[model samples]
Target: MNFTPLHRALGLPPCPLTDEILSDAVTSGVTETDDLDWKSELPPIKGLSQTDVPKDIAAMANSGGGMIVYGVEEHGKAATGRSDAGEFTEGHERAYRSVAVTAISPPVFGLEVHRLGTECRAVAVVIPASVDGPHLIYKNDFFGAPIRNDADTAWMKERQIEAMYRARFNERRRATEAVDSLFAEAAEGRDTVERAWLIAVAHPRVPGALTRLTRDEAREVFNDARTITLSFSKNTGIHPLDNVEYLNPRPGLRRWVAPNAATGDRSIWKESWVSVHHDGSVSLATAVGGHRMSSDGYWEGWQVEGRGVECAVADFMALIRAAARSLHLDEYDVRVGVEWSGEQPLSILTVDGSGFPYDGVSTPLRAFTSARSTVTASASDADFHRQTRELAEDCVNQGGITYLHVIEPLPEDEN
Candidate 1:
C-alpha cells in the first residue's frame, strides 16, 4: 500500500512515472510479492469462467490490498515483457469494476484503473485494503475470492474470516470517532460565525491508504497548487499562496490554501481550502463570504437574474477537480454541501447563453453532482472537460435551460 500500489505493480517509484520507469523495470528487474502481482494478459471481462481476474483481485483485497498489473509478460513473479495491457479495450475498466463491485462483499471503493499515458496497454488496477474485509469472492472465480498466501492466492481460513467480520464493527467505530474528534479541528481557528461555508468532505470507503503515503508525497501535491485551478475565457484563479508551509496536523491529514485573501489569512475557507488524508482520501471547501459577482459579471443580483446558480456550480466544479489532481486520484466519491450563514439564495438558475426563454428558473443544488472530471484534471484525457460539464448541462437542461455557459465569472461585490 505504500507505493501508490499501482506504481509498485508497474515496478516504478512512488511518484507518477514516465515510460522510462517501465523500461527500467524490464531491464533491471521486477519481482512480485504478496502485495504485488501481475498477469500476462487482461482477460475478457465477460464469460466469467474465462477470466482469473476475480481471483487475483479477491486475493489482493483479502490480503490487505495491492496492485495487479495486467497485460504484461512475467516469469515466476517478475514482470518480463512489454505493455500487454495495450490489448485491452476502453470498456475493460468498466467491465472489471462491475464484477469487482458485485463479486466482492462490502464492495471495494477507490479502485484506480489507469493506463500509462494514452498509448500503453499495461493497465494498473489498484485495489485498496478494506477495513470491511475478508472480501469474500461471492461470484464466479472461486468459492469467494481467495487471500494471498505467500506469493500465491489461496482461500481464506475460517478463523481469518471470523476476525474480519468482528473487526468491521471496530472499523465503523473508528470512522465515527474520526469525524467527532476531527470535525471541530477541521476548521479550528479558521471558523467564523459570520462567514458562510461550502464544505466538500471525502471519506474513504476503504481506509488505511494514507498510512502508506509519505509526508513528502503530501507536500509534493501541495506544491502543485500554483497551477491547479479554474480557467475560463482568459480568466484563471485558485493559485497556491507563495511560501505557504505544508499543513500536516496529524498523520494522514494535510491542508493548504490558495492565495492570500485581503485579510492575509488563508487558513479558513474564505478563498479555498484543500485537505488530504493518508488513505489517499481528500476534501476541499471554499467560502462565499466576501464581495462576489454573478455569472455574467454582475455583482448585485443574488436572486433576480439567478446568477448565483451558475457561479456556485462553476466554483464547486473547479474546487473538486483541483482536489482530485492534487491528491493523485483518478476517481473518488465526493459530497459537496453549502453551509449558509447569511440568507440563503432563493434558488440556483439554469441558463444557456443568449436566448433561453426560461433563463431564470428554480434549480436544485444536486444538478451539479453528475460531472466528475473537469477540464483542469487532465485536458488530454478523453472527454476530460465534457465528462463533468455534460452532466451539469443535462441536469439543468432538463429544467428547460437549453444552453449552459460553464465559464461564469465570479460576481462583483456590492460595495
Candidate 2:
C-alpha cells in the first residue's frame, strides 16, 4: 500500500542498477557451479521441475543476493546462444513466478525476468538474501530446509535454524530502520516538478559533457524576456541546445524546456524538440507541429522533412491552428516564422507584426511540444530544458529540420 510497494517488496535498494552492471555481475561468476549448489550438478535442464529448483531458491535467499544463470554451460562458462536467452521454456518463467509465490514459506517478491540478448542461450534470476533465514522447499516427497553459507549452500540443522530465527529478528529491526531512513530522505524534498526536470535534462544512455547555469541567469532568460535564442557548437556527443533554465512561477506551476531550436535565418531547414517532466517523464515531439502549420499556409513556405517547401509551410500553419485549439489560444495571437544561419543549432525568427514572440516563453505552446517529446511533466524545468536542447541538436544533425519557430501561444493582446 506504500507509494512504491513493488520496489519495497523486492527488498532492492532505491536505485535500479543498469543492464550493463547486472550483466557484468552475472558473467563474473554469479552463476552457480557444481562446487556451489547441488542444482548445478543436475545439468542445465530445460526448466526447473518442482523438486530441483526450490532448494536452490531457498539456498540463494539464505545465502545473499546472487544470480542463477540458467541454460548456460557449466564447464564452457559461456552463454547458451539461444535467441530468447531468459524467456521461459514455454512454462518456465511462469512456473518460476508461480512457485515463488506459493511454495516459499514467507513469499519472495521483486524477481525480475528479462531477455539476455538475441540469443536465448541464458537466463539469470537474482535472489535476494532472506531476512527470515532458512526457508523450507517442499516439492512433493522431497522436503528440505536450506541456508546459504558464503558462496555455498548447505542443509540446515536444528541449531542453525534457531540461530537463523534470532538473526531474522535482528534483520527485521535493521530493515525497519533502513526503510524509515529512506522514507525520511525521500520526503525531505517533495519537489516532483523539479525532480522530473532533472530526469529530463540528464543525458540518455550515452556519456556526454554537462554545462551548468546560475539560478539568476535562468530566471532572467525565462522571465521578462520576449524571445530567447539558443546556440550550440556541434559535437559528437549530443548536447542540449539551450542550457538548463528553471521556471517556477507558483506552487504547482512550473515548466522545463528541453534542448530545441527556436529558429534559423534560412527558410529551408529541419529542427527537433525534446521535453522532460519532473515525474520521470520523457517525450520526443519532432517538427511535426511546424510541418502542420506550414502545410496550412499559416506561415511562409519553409523546408521540412518528408515534405516540399510549400507543403511544409501549409503543414506548419495547420500545426499552429491545432496548437491554438489544444492550448486555447487564438491563431492571430500566435507568431509563425523561421530563422537560420546562426551559431545556434536552430535560430528562431518571429513574424513581424504577429504580436509578442512566444518563441522562448514557458507557455503551453512550448509545453505542448515538450510534453509531446517526453510525455512526463513531473520533472524539474532546468533538466527538461537541458534535454530538449540536446534533442534539438540531434535533430538538426540528423537532417530532421533546419529552423525552429513558435506556432502557438499568441499574445492575448494580438490582433
RMSD of each: 8.7, 18.9
Predicted model with the maximum lDDT? 1
**Over the stretch 88-153, how does candidate 1's per-residue lDDT look in tens digits?**
565766777777777667565557665653565577677867666767665445465488887788
**Tens-digit lDDT track of model 2 for 246-347:** 243211212234333535533212333332222211122223223223343432222232122212222222222222222222212111122222122332
* lDDT (Cα, 0-100) at 166 in candidate 1: 81
Candidate 2: deviation at residue 396, Å? 53
Task: Give the least accurate 10-residue stretch of model 2, judged by summed lDDT.
Answer: 198-207
Runs off by more than 4 Å, candidate 2:
1-49, 76-91, 139-143, 149-152, 176-415
Model 1 lDDT, full chain set: 0.50
